[model samples]
Target: MRYPLLMRFLFLTFLLLCASLHADESPDTIAPIRERAMEHQKAGRFAAAVDDFIKCIEEGSKTNRTGRRAEYFARIAYNQTRMGNFKDARENMEKAPRQNGWKDEDPFLMEMRAIVFLATDQIEPALQIAQKFKAVNPKKAEYFEMVAQFFGGDEKCLATPLGRFLFDPEQLLYNGAVARNPKDLIARRRRAAYFLERANQQRFPNSYPAKIPVDRGGWAHLFDPATAAGLPYSFYASAFYDLSRALEMCSSQDEPFLRVRRAGAAYGWNAVAPKNSLFISAATIAGDLKRAQKQGALDVRTQRALGDFFSETLPPVDQPNYRPRLRSGIQSYSRALYFTRDESSLRDPDWLETPETDSLQKVRAARSTLIGFHLSGKPVALPDLPPLTELAWKDYGNTLVAREELGSALEAYKKALEFDPEFVPALNNIGTVYSRLGAFDIALEWFDKAVKADPKFAIGWTNRAGVLDELGDVEKSLASYDTALGIEPQNAQTWVSRGILAMNSKSWASGQNAFAQAARLAPQNSRYAALSAFAKFANENAELPKIDLSIEDKTWLSNFFGSDSLAESYASKGAADKVFAAREWIK
Candidate 1:
């Protein structure tokens, strides 16, 4: 899977032509050493290849192909790895700078160092280097997988962020640095991670709120054992994982809903500990009222209002089921209305006039807001919005974003922020829209605002890292990526993005490794597969497949993503040439 093999071959030919086009050095002077290194690398004499490439780099100093020099260093690092010189390879490859032109240094050399370290039972260093590489390019899937393997797979590592919850109350899921869980939590975690990954990948669809990652047994099913009992154990396992995440959120905040959820879980589990006990029904309301009173000033009124809202809103039950839930929802809503002036608008006559009127009015308002803000590129007014607790704005914002009416989406998001100035999603969506509009600086501002709002938001960190990479702020991008992976190591998209950035950095060896990771994380992604092949071929210095300008290639470029330039380029020179030439411009 090296650099779409066809693209690789064409790129090599292009590179060769570029070399010939420039009279900096005779082919004879450089070719012999390069060919020798290629031979050694091909025959598995990696050490020999390293030596030859090193010499070639020194000899090429008379020329100004810093890119070429970097490429050689990268390849040498790859060769050193086969010879088991992991430390040296890593040290040397780190010196390579990103190419100014199209040249990429050996993409997989650093990846190999980390890979081989793991193969040699060097877990700690492998993890560290792997994390470093991923931060530079988080899109590499294989690298992420390798890192996960070292930590006992996805589920085992979920415990890293919440050791107490994921590993059991006593943290007994692992023994002396190895996973002790036999239920295959690792694989389950990986599967569950995909739900989140896909949710993120869907790019906030244009109609419905982008799909939510709902796990029946995980967070989705944590409410009742009866619901979980209907599903397979695996379903429950994933649900538990989500529940753990939800609980983690609760532990970090004093959110009333989360607290209620905890009380519910405790009630469901019926654990004897006081912390594990829960109150439901009227008792739940009483508890909320008590908390409000303790905080002072109209807290009691707010709590009672919530109880009234719940009593009116809760659906009639044939039996006494879901009492706790009703109480929780009511209390939650009451707090929302009590906290902010903006949310008070939810009590507007348009909404309270009738249920149908409320629904339709809200939807129209959301649409108008999104259109006004994002499409029109107007500054959002933060005044006269709903309260943060109402969550009306979040709901409306998500609705508009789903419709692909980015302008409308922006407004809805802006309005949400007016309600909750510290809301993460509002900040995130605003940044996304700004990025779409090529307003990178403004996007960075919103993303920065999101990070400031909730430092624990992994998605914010990852997306911000992506913006930084796009802006060519490689060092800062790497730092942001580190923050993301540290928060959510299982995010495959982050791995892939990291990989792409690494490749673009002109450290060919590192790029190749990053691509490998991207491919592994998303095996079905054609881009990842193509890049993987390209990276491998580039490192080998072997002939790449000629780009076929055939109808098929044309269709792939034109019909698929409307890549007319790419199709034309491929038609004239080859697919590889077209891909390389169009890579930056296409996206």
Candidate 2:
């Protein structure tokens, strides 16, 4: 009955070979791998979950069973949709068998199909597919009903038991994931649309007594600011509320639904270029330029992409010294523009460009120190400006700013404001001029108005923070600066300013770290590099003062300052380095 030694060895070797082969097998070969992928999907780790789902789909497709293959394809399509891979999602959906019996009616398959359509902004088609589930799938009837109601506009459906569950934050978040966004330019924009759709049902509720749910709760609709506890009953109010929530959510730190949040929500803001920081979706910028380049160099799209690279900076700091990249990019843009004559505009009929204004060339010149044209022989002639319009005046102001003629710039800004009273850029520029002139209070006023004119104008916050710092409201200044960073964390100038504030506060190490960040963000900025070097030198030469530390200060330094062994070091050890390092941030 006992096995021979040779047979036992052969059996063990076969098992080892099988194990080795399994490592290279599709994800579904291991049940736990598939389960982990599902877990990743549920946790909104879409990018990571995508590969695992594809492996599972490959395993399923390898099977002879048509139903199993269809199910895998359908499931993977949902994951692909979440990953912003519209092409892959569509291909998977197409490959899945529509005629396979029962698999055709599978709720998950049907839901994914609707999801794909919805994600691409095909609402009517998605709603129709979702509607089929109402009678065909009883367990999912509530979910399908919720979808129909979102598109159908009926509050009565929401008052139903199923509606309560389906309209909850959990459900709306799933729908938000399916909203029309690929590069994540705006997650809150999608969430806003979700709430706006939900609120449409209640545009004019027919329940005469106005039977609002006493406490079944409005948590699901938190993203829908319209459903706030004490709002007046106007659809406009609700819609506007959602709109406000959308903008506010652009930088809110503590969004509860981080799991369902877009990738941008995590790392959306960071320095894209040297000595400049602005709120830019790098994905959108790259995507747009790629699309534009297909049209050729003469195309307005191509020129504009180059122009943005040349002239655009967050908050438009009057940085007289531009980096080499700016000059190179502007040189490229000017070369394209020079192809046409010193004629009327960027849109001369013979130039074969679109209807952009004549001011674009002038504005470009004003924005940079580069020669107005790449070819000196083909120099762009500056036309005399009697500014009748806001844009013309704005360009004139730009010219004045370039020349350091603050008085003339101020007048030009005034003219711009007179032409268009709500011009936010002029408002910001007025603040900039006043700040430059050391008129801090007036500058702050204009900055406030600029933000009021357009809260999403990140430059307003940055400019306002500078004014606040000048006025010596240190706490308020810090808060304002933080707000600006929240809005557009990529601004290297702002990081430099933040570092200066840290240095002023005598948090030497924190200031050093902040300066390092600024230097990393803008290595071309000589000022930031100098400040970083100084901070490092200061830290290296740290010397403890004779002043005794309070227990609270000691606790703070130990806990928050990453010097956890400070108390022990200062008391037991006479290490001069430890003493000095511990005192680096102390009062």
Candidate 3:
């Protein structure tokens, strides 16, 4: 107690330092406020708890008390729910302060809000919010199921006309009726299948019923399980499968229309290329070519068919396989340098040798770099085409065309036509090339001559329609499309083209119908599926609110319904974007 002043000060400093090191740290400065809020919440003083939590959150916001901020927000949300303030709770939950790298806070809040809606029997709203949450975070499959169970009630809701046909509880009894009343069965089933297939076929493939979130009441399962199962190839497998079977099952007196129906189905499904947007199935085209070559005396129709096959079988527009990378010494040296270089600088030459490699690497480094360096606002310069000796000017013209020099392409085509005045393909190609360059008049002149020379050419009719459409002559364009369809009704692309024209003409009903028909013909087409959904929504009585046009159209249910209970109820458990996209068509 009587120690010297300096010794006492030194001893006190050491003691204070020791105490500071051993102090029980508060993770959040507002920890006491968070604890008080929880206590108030537990005592059923929800409003008081909310007030305290809000204060805590405000305090945390001022300071860097992240944990306390989240705790307060989470508590406030819970108390709001307990007080039966569903709307307030939803707002609070949605506005819950996000913590850097803090897991589960946002989703937990979303899940709680969904529960509040469910407690109040706001089934639709519950489903919509749950679906939004699920879409944002797909790993939570439970959220999807939660909404689906409510929308897809144990007994289907008898709300709409389609529901009467679709939500039949007495499935087994209906099956028995189909067997006994064969004619009626054929009629009903055919009509039912037609409508169902129409619904199934949309412009966007992702819009298929199956693609709808499982949480939205499993409506897609309607036809796939019951009605479609009775058909030849289940409608589940192919939308046209049941229609095809119906054609076979129907009476022989119905032969002519049946052929038309069958042909329509064939065109829809058959014309669609497998895998991607390839115009024709390579296997099928190859087989056709082999047959045509083997039978040298094939008829004109067969020859033309082969030509059509050739036209469609060309490589995809984006991923053209024409230019294979040289893969010569340039690539070998590049790889060799990578192995030899020990220092990063030495590897510089390896990168330099292969410009594409370095460019690709830069793209990988950052997408912005790729766009800035390679694909920015630069014009595409075409490489000169190798000279063709037959006619010097013609060769020059073709070289320009090959380089995507539109003017040059037109000039080349003209030169080629000058050399061989009766070259039908060249004339047709010239018209198409010119049409692409927006030279409608010139394109029309050439197309007219091509059609006159080859009256039965389907391409001429299709191409003529394209030019007509560009020229804003929709009615005539539609006529041309019809002419093309008459020659080849099974072409899905042509159906799509016609459907687009119809849509552009404000024939939403007919446009959707046409799109549906096209989708039925090609079940796997995503664009067709999406368009079909849009069409159905257009026809349906369900209201679609006018959302902001600036928002990116998701083409899915989750996006449309958003946090609304009814919207959530119909959203897909799996893909939300497609579901939101579909919702727009509802009104």
Candidate closest to the true structure, highest lDDT: 2
Model 2 deviation from the true structure expressed as Cα RMSD, one decimal place: 21.9
User: Judged by lDDT against the true structure, how good is candidate 3?
Assistant: 0.48
Question: Which regions of candidate 3 are displaced past 4 Å?
Answer: 1-399, 541-587
| TM-score of each prediction | 0.28, 0.32, 0.29
Compared with the true structure, what per-residue lDDT tens digits does model 1 show for residues 1-587? Answer: 77699898999999988876685555447778889888767554455677799878777765544446666766766555433344566566565544322233223544544544442334566566656665457655333443334334334444454332222221112221223332333332333333233322232235325343322222211112234322222232232233333333332322333233222222222221124222122354356444433332222223333333343334444336444434343333333333324433333221122243253244234323322323443333334644554267666666666665565667677777776788888888889876664445457889999999999999899888876765546778878987997898767667666755654554456656766777787887776666666555444432322322121222323332345653464457445553554353334
Better of 1 and 2 by lDDT: 2
TM-score of 2: 0.32
Query: How many clashing pairs in candidate 3?
Result: 43
lDDT of 2 by residue, 144-234 (tens): 5455444333354467675654344432443345343422424434443333333323432452233343222222222122333322222
- Candidate achieving higher TM-score, 2 or 3: 2
List of clashing residue pairs for candidate 2: 169-220, 270-490, 277-490, 277-491
Worst 10-residue lDDT window for candidate 1 reads: 167-176
- The TM-score leader among the candidates is 2
| Higher-ranked by TM-score: 1 or 2 | 2
The per-model lDDT (C-alpha) reads: 0.48, 0.52, 0.48
